[model samples]
Target: MTEGKRAIIQQLLQEYDIQDAQDIQDALKDLLGGTIKEMMESEMDQHLGYEKSERTESEDADRNYRNGYKSKRVNSSYGSMDIDVPQDRHSSFEPKVVKKRQKDISDIDQKIISMYAKGMTTKQISETIDDIYGFEASEGFISDVTDKILPQIEEWQERPLSAVYPIVFIDAIHFSVRDDGVIRKLAAYVVLGINSDGRKEVLSLVIGENESSKYWLSVLNSLKNRGVQDILILCSDGLSGIKEAIQTAFPKTEQQRCIVHMVRNTLKYVANKDMKAFAKDLKTIYTASDEKTALSQLDRVTDKWDGQYPYAMKRWHENWDAISPIFKFSKDVRTAFYTTNAIESLNSTLRRLNRQRSVFPSSQALLKALYLATFEATKKWTSPIRNWGKVRGELSIMYPDRMPD
Candidate 1:
């Protein structure tokens, strides 16, 4: 078989008047077109219970026989090639390799979909394909390719999840989307979970009108309905009502407000001259040896800067309850959940991809864009979390009941 294939290829190479790579490629396309046509003819012969030239009388006289070939122009990256597909009298023969009405013999749709998933715009994808291959793929064709993933995304959104997640980082990335013919800011809420094996997975993603506790509640409830029984640590930026939402969904889950977000919110009130000193003093509260020491450092921070920026102090005090949970875990485990950095990194990638798209045409368009960006971003999450062995050991001790064997 190998020798036969090599002989056929050698014969094809000899038949082409080789001048450059393009000429060789054209010859190869012709070879493939002929090969495919022959395969379909063989398929028809097998269906009719006889060879192409042999005239045989079978038991079933009503059985369909091979009819003349129907030419089909197939679009491919190699170039436009025509295949003569075999037909039957009853039109019942189905070829497995190239089905009927399948104009894309080269799987160009998958290529377009792959490009779209890599954050390429429809126009960019079309141009890229045209530049590489002498084929015309319109923006609508690109969109249709991407639309095929929507059902897969929908099924993924509704799929069942692990019963428990050791730590979950929830954050929202804002984008401009059109709704009801009006452009508005929309939030894409992402739930990044650390599973038992210490791998990060995007458990759920939901697009909402705005980032609010009310919307987060629905997201959390959706997780609950999808079989997320317990989340030991829920980390998020200091969004109002998130604590209440967590309480309602998983009352036992410990909430850790991102210290980085708190510092940024507090820094808004501090003057430039005092910003460095203020941030230094504020770090003492979150980076202290223990919770009591952190609380004492918090008092000192309030005393030193409260008169100048009372609201900043008030904001810290108001959020202290949510922020204090991080102190309970070991430093190794706490490092993973003390801030929303994990989700923020994902958001940063999304911002880079979407910077060109100022306002999406619709909410569905924005969702599709985000889903594609995320699908591409998560492809690199192959390695396990850094020092996960040590972190998981610490987490096991902290949340013994929730830890898996």
Candidate 2:
């Protein structure tokens, strides 16, 4: 140590009545303990709007006052310490820095949750905590930390939705989860909706055994129960029975088959050598100004390719009713309903986090991770949809009674 620093330390020791290293350490502990006690008293003062022993003759004096102090042993990086927490007469002063019955004085729990949300495994999270905090934390403790948010996630899932959504996109992403000692692939059905303000929000995340229409109908029922009265457009892939389910549950809703998925499924039937040329020809059909023009171009392509690729042409013609909704609206509104890209983008983010986990221990575990990931992913959706004003104008004209004023 430098001579100046040594002299300063010596001066502090002499002034503070410290005699040795142990004494200095004890003094420092006393200082911290006293500061915490004082802060608690200060918090009570703020809560009651007056310090201890301070009185007023007015009616305010009859309000709450300091009752007593309760002792709590809190674990800190400086080692365990005992501090006295002040209480109010009404037992209502809740201290934020040190809450009642809190055991730890550090932010280790929050750090563990943040790391887990970024797709870190339990072992990795534990190791990270150990490395940074100089203490070992068990995986069970880490699990407990993440499990605390499960109830909140469940509540979020069941919360009421808006009365109407202008457009909603639905899609399913698959994951492996262990159920009853057997690992199985599960489908996470996601719903992204645009509310009256044109802001996008995740409506629901449902875990199912598979992406069957039966589970999807249950999801739609859940939405209906949560007050989703009308949905102008519901976009999805050409999943079987979905259109029927929508007809039964929400007869007014129009099904818009995902044009991107249609294009992808059509390309699967085209030969590798003809994919580029075929895609160019397929574009002419979807991008046409109106249904009549689009169908005319589609017929031209059917004439050119039907002899070689009958199934692709047949699939397009079969789903023409579902695909026709996009053509009725203007280009901006039509483009929004033509694909499920909004929800697909959300799924892409979940997939990135899911890539780190080969299999989840349970459905609850998968849901917890998904909820956290969704929370983090939606932060970027701060602005309204592109060309929202124009689309809203068109939608208002189409659904005059349904649109929000």
Q: Could you give the C-alpha RMSD of every candidate to the true structure, in order shown?
A: 2.7, 7.0
What does the lDDT come to for candidate 2?
0.84
Candidate 1 local lDDT, residue 82: 82
lDDT of each: 0.83, 0.84
Identify the candidate with maximal TM-score: 1
lDDT of each residue in 1-405, candidate 1, tens digit only: 699999976786788887888888888788788888888878887898788898776767676777888888887768778888888889899997688878787788778877766667788889988888777888988888888888988998999999999889988778888778888887787889988888889998887765567877888999989999999889888766788899988998999888888888889998899999999998888888789998999999899888888888887787788889878766666778888876666888888756767777777767777787788888888877777888888888878777877
Model 2, span 166-196: residue lDDT tens: 9998887888899899999888878899998
Clashing pairs in 1: none
| Per-residue lDDT of 15 in model 1 | 84
Look at candidate 2 and tell me the lDDT of residue 263: 94
Worst 10 contiguous positions by lDDT, candidate 1: 207-216
TM-score for every candidate vs. truth? Answer: 0.90, 0.79
